[model samples]
Target: MATIYDVAKQAGVSPKTVSRVLNGDAPVGARTREAVEAAIRALDYRPSSAARTMRSSRSGLVGLITGAISRGDGSAGPSGLPDLFIVQAIQRVVAEAGMTLMIADTGGEADRAVELMATFAQHRAEGLIYVADSHQRIEDLDPRGTPLVLANCFDAAGTPAVLPDDRAGQRALVERVIAAGHRRIAYLTLPEGMIATELRSRGYREALEAAGIAFDPALVIEGFADHGEGPRPYIASALDRLLALEDRPSVICCGNDELALRLYGELRDRGIRVPQEISVAGYDDYRVISETLYPPLTTADLNYRGIGEAAARRLLALIAGAPAPTEAEVIGGPVCWRQSVTEH
Candidate 1:
C-alpha cells in the first residue's frame, strides 16, 4: 500500500507539506500542490479518514435522518410519493462541499430519530439534519448540543430549519390561474389540521381577494381524509359538490398532483373535457402525474430539492459556528403552466 511518506518522496516535498496539501488546512504553493496531486494520482494514494479525523477532530461527516428511503410502498407524507428528491439534492450539495453524508432511515417511526442521532454521534458526525416527508411540526428532538437543522419540517425549539413556502407556492399558482382569466375558481384541499392545508388555503383565498373575486366557502372542499383514516372517495364527492353549485367553477385547483390525477379520472367519467369544459390544476408538480396527464396538468413546484439544498447549507454553516436562524428558512418554486389551464 502507498503511504503519505511514499507520496511525499515521489513528489519531492516534505511529509509536512504533503500533509498540508492533503488536509487543505494550510495553504500550499500552486506548483507544490500540483506536484503533490500528481504524486497522489500516480500512486493512487487513499487517505485514511480515521487518521484525518484524529488530527482535525472533524469527521467530515454529516448525519441525515429521514424516512424517505425506507418506505417500502414508496408512499410519503401528503403527496403519496417518496421524498427522495429532497434526499437526492442534499446528497449532491454535501458531496460538492466535500463532506460525507451518513444517512439513517427512521423506518417510518418518528420515535427512532433520537436513537439514530445517538448512532451518528458515535460516528463523530460534525452536524445533523432531519428531513420530514411533509411540511409539519416535529417535536421532542433534543440534538444534545450537536448542530442540527430541519428540512421540510419545523419545531418550536428554534432549530434551524428549511421548509417549502407552501403559502407562497399556492398563492403563485392561483395568481397564474387568475391571470389566465379564471374567476370562479374552486379548491379541492388537503385534509384539515395539516400545516400545509391551512397555509395553502390562506394562499388560495389571498389570491382570490387580490383578483377582486369574492371568497366563496362553498367552492372549497376537503379532498382527502386525515392521516391514519383510510382513504375515502373524497375527490368524487368534492367534484360532485363543485359541479352542483348554482354557478359551477370554470377551473379547479387540487391540493396536490395525486388529487389532480384522481380528479382527472373523475372528470373524465363525468364527460368533462379539461380546459375546454373545465380547467384543472394541482400542487407539488409530481411530474409523473402532471406531465403525463393527457393535457399536461398545471401545478406548483414545491421545490423539495431547493429545501434540501438550503437545509444542507444551513447545517454546514451551523457546524462552522454560525448563529442559528431566528426563523425557519422558507423556499418557494415557480408555478408551472401547462395545457390544463386556459385563458378564459
Candidate 2:
C-alpha cells in the first residue's frame, strides 16, 4: 500500500501539502492540486480508514500512553484514580478533535510505556500523550520525534504536557479544612519521590503557615502498605500513631482517593468519626471510589477529560506543522465539596 509519503514525493510537495490535498483543509493551487491528484492516481495510493476519518472528522490519529503502578487489589495491576480520570478525559477530547485514539496502560512499568510507544509509532500515531499514575520523574523516555504531551507528568524534557494544578488543590482543600476551625491537621502520604507526594506536601505546609499554625513534622505520617494497596494497613498504622500522639490532630488530609477511602474505613473501625472526631479530605474525584465511599469523599476534580481533549488538539496541530504551545499547560481542578470534611 503506497502511503501518503509516496504520493508527496511523486508530486514533489511536502507531506503537509499532501495531507492538505487529502484532507481538503487548505486550498491548493490548481496546479498543485492537479499534481497531487495525478501522483495519487499514479501511485494507486489508498488512504486507511483512520486517514479518511481524519479528512472527514477533522482530527488525525493520536496515541495515549499511560503508566499504572501495577498494584494488586485482586486486579491485573496498579490503581490510581486521578490518572484514570485523565485517561478517560483524553478519550473524550480526541473524539471531539476529529481524531481516533488508541491507548496503552503501562501498569507502572516504564518498559511497558516504551514498548507501547514503539507500537504507537508503528501505527503512525500523529501525536502521543504520556500519562503517569503519579508525578514520578520519568527516566530515559524518548518519543522519537513524535509530538508529545504529558498528562499529570512533571518533566522538564519531552514535549508539552498537561499537569494538574495540585499546588492549588492542596492549598484550597487545606485552607478550607483549617477555616472550619479544625486545628492539628494530619497529612498521611504515600512513599516519598512521588509527584503528588511533593506537591500535596507543599500544600500541607503552606496551608499550615497560612493558618498561623507551626508546621509539625511529627504529625505527618506515611503509609507503607503490608497486605495490599488501599487505605487499610497504612491507615490503621497511621491512625494508631496519630491518635497515640500527645496532641492528635482534629483533621487529616490524604494523598489520594484510594488512601482517603482506606483512612475512612480504618477510622470507622477505630470508632473515630469523620468530620466529627477528625475532618478528612482527599484528592482525585474518582467516580465510583468517591461517589460510593461511606461518607462520600471531598476531593478535587482534576479535569482529565479536558486535558486529554487539549492534548489531542495539540498533537493534531503538531502533525499539521502548527507551532507548538509556547509553555507547559497546567490543567486545573475543581473542588468537589462532599461530606467527608466538616467545619469545626
Candidate 3:
C-alpha cells in the first residue's frame, strides 16, 4: 500500500527525485539516493511498474517463445523438455536485469510462432527471445520489427543468436579421445540436416586431421535425430558396419547421452565389455544417462543454460538500439571424462 510519494515525504525529497533514484533514469547524489533507498525500505514501498512504464515509455517486459517449456504432463518425449533449462536461465537473467519475462510455449508447433509473437507485440514487449530445444534453423517467423535474439537456434534472416559451440565442443572431445591413445575412432551422429549434426561432423573430421589421422569416410554413420526416433535400427546398423571394418575403431563417439545409453545396452547384449573391447563416449552429458550408466559415460556438456543467459543479454542490448550480430554467438562448454573411455 506504500507509494513513491510516501517514500519521498519520508526522505525529504520531491517525488521526481525519488523517481530518478528508483528508475535510475537520471543521476542523483549518493547521499540523496541512500536516503531515498532507506526510506523505501522503511516504508516497504513498492513502485508501480505501470506508472514507471507510462513515464519512461519502457514496458520493462521481454517475451520468450519456446517449444521446450510446456504445461502438459511431464512426459513430452524421450528428451523430456530439454530446452527447459534454457528457459529457466533466461528467466533468471531477465529478472536480474530488472525486467519481467513473458513466456509462450508453442507446444512443439512451429506454425504458432507468428501468433505468439503477435500477442507479445500486443502486450508491448520491448524485446523477444526464441529458445529452441536443439541447434536448428527456424523459418517463417514474423518479428514485426521487435528486437529479437535466438537461443540454441538460428534464424535464416541473420537474426542475432546465441548457440552451443557444437563444432568446438565435439572437436575438443575428439582431441581428448585422441590424447587417450585412440587412433581409429568411429562417430555415430545425429540426422543429416540438423545444425548440431553438421557442426559436430565437421569437428570430428577436423580433430582427426589435426591428429594426423586420415579422414575415413567409413568411420562416420548417421543416427537418429529426434528423441521419438529411438536408437535401435540406426545404432545397430552402424555398429555392425563398424565392427566389420578391417581397422575397427577402438573408440565409439555417440551424438548425445540418449544415444550413448542405447549404445551401452546394445554393446552389453552383444557380450562386449566397455573400455575393455571398445571405448565409448557421448555428448550432451544428460546426467541420467552419462552418470548412471555402468561405466559412467564420458561426454560433453551442451551448455544450454549458458546459451539462454547469453541470448537474454543480447536481446536486452538489441532492444537498447545496439547493432545486431550478423553471425551466431557460439558458447562453448567443457568435456566430461568418465570411466567409459580408456587409453585405447
Top candidate when judged by TM-score against the true structure: 1
* Candidate lDDT (C-alpha), each: 0.88, 0.74, 0.86
Please give the lDDT score at residue 18 for candidate 1.
Answer: 98
lDDT of model number 3: 0.86
> How well is each residue in 125-154 modelled by candidate 3, as lDDT tens digits?
999888877787879478898998888878
**lDDT, candidate 2, residue 58?**
35
Candidate 3 Cα errors over 4 Å, as ranges: 1-48, 71-81, 225-230
lDDT of 1 by residue, 1-344 (tens): 89999999999999999999988889999999999999999999999978988897788999999998887465433543567888889999999999999999998899999999999988889999998888989885877778999998888887889989999999999999999988999998888888899999999999998889999999999886654544446677778899899999999998888888888888898899998999999998888888999899999999989999999999888888888889989999999999999898
Query: Which residue pairs of candidate 1 clash?
Result: none
Alpha carbon deviation, residue 98, candidate 1 (Å): 0.9
Ranking by TM-score: 1, 3, 2
RMSD of each: 4.3, 6.8, 4.8
Name the lDDT value of residue 145 in candidate 3: 86
Candidate 1 TM-score, true structure as reference: 0.86
Better-scoring candidate (lDDT), 1 or 3: 1
Per-prediction TM-score: 0.86, 0.75, 0.83
